[model samples]
Target: MTQQKAVLRSDGFTFKQFFVAHDRCAMKVGTDGVLLGAWAPVADAKRVLDIGTGSGLIALMLAQRTGESVAVDAVELDEQAAVQAQENAAASPWASRISVYRDDIRHWTQRCEHRYSLIVSNPPYFTPGSDCATPARASARSTTDLTHDMLLNCAESLITEDGYFCVVLPTTAGDRLLTLALQHGWHLRFRTDIADNDRRPPNRVLLALSPHPGEEFLDRMTIRGPDQRYSEAHCSLTRDFYLFR
Candidate 1:
């Protein structure tokens, strides 16, 4: 089935991203990407890799926050999304520092020789039996496109010994992924659980893992407070990327 396309305008953050057009992918630029981008670690990273780059949102965010000191590379499996990502990168202030490739993460890792200080992915996390309204959506949300094992393997191969691997996934799959990481000898460094509001259970887990880690640091972030307004923690976490604090 043919995928439907959409054009997304920038939210006027530092990155000022504009997704010209995209199809054949389930996910688009949304709150998840923004939250992940703003929350990912970027303090001392010299080189970064973004897997399943999609609209290149995370790459742009890293570029905006890191300046030209850090080089960012993005990998996308979908041809259309890759093209759009390149365009978005070119349009950004850090165009010279960002590069987008139309390749799968598994293939990219096999050919990658340079090691990254940080790797981030807002990957496909929906498990089986979840509702998928369309083929494109299924491809966007399912692990079939890029399995957890594939991501972990790439992380092990592409990241340096001291580098960090970070991702945001559904809470259900997050624990399982952490288990898989432990099995692969990777250590969880930091974690944050997210909920829509104070009343709801955490639906997403944001994690940062590394090879040189002692003990995992776990935290929680509630997106909204009891008033149904943005929580102070959430606002602070996203203040750098969002137009309004």
Candidate 2:
């Protein structure tokens, strides 16, 4: 498939993102990727994998945090996205440490030789019966692209015995994912519920899972206060990467 190049402009950065110039993929680089990129755990990680690495945002962020020695791989099913992810990685400072694979996660897992110390994803969570305006959006948002059971199975197979699997998802879908993880013997290690503001209910959940037994560390994070400004905690959490601070 021919790849079409595009550009994305945010407050702090201008990025060239590639797509099938004319294809259907519901998601583009958005706030969700930024949040997951900035919030995922990476300390002392030797090997990491970014599943469904749409824009290579999370992999680049990991590169920024980890040393040059770490190895990072990203998997993308969309051909255009895979190309774009490679372009993004090449343009970043951590280019030498990151590689992009244009393939399905299920197939990639079968041939992967080494286990990753960290596995992270911002997965498609919208389940069946949800409202979707277009085929692209449905593909990007719905579990039809990658089911929860499949994600769990892949994580169980790809992650090392002590590795951590981190993900961000809508709170509604997160509940089902947590239940499935338990059934598969993947223990929940940490979780944070995120709200747009203090007055609103949580819309997203960030979670870390592992095979080792441990109690869950649960917390809540509100992005904004009543003043409609970023909360101190939010700023602190993302200050390292975000230009707002």
Alpha-carbon lDDT, every model: 0.81, 0.79
lDDT of 2 by residue, 168-233 (tens): 998988888999999999999989899999889999999899999887799999988888777888
lDDT of 1 by residue, 104-179 (tens): 7898888988899999999888765568998767766888878898889989998888899999988888899999
- Worst lDDT window (10 residues) for model 1? 1-10
Q: Model 2, poorest ten-residue lDDT window?
A: 1-10
Q: Runs in model 2 with CA error above 4 Å?
A: 1-25, 128-134
Task: For model 2, state the Cα shift of residue 239 in Å.
Answer: 1.0
Per-prediction tally of clashes: 0, 0
Superposed by TM-score, candidate 1 places the C-alpha of residue 22 at a distance from the truth, in angstroms, of 5.3
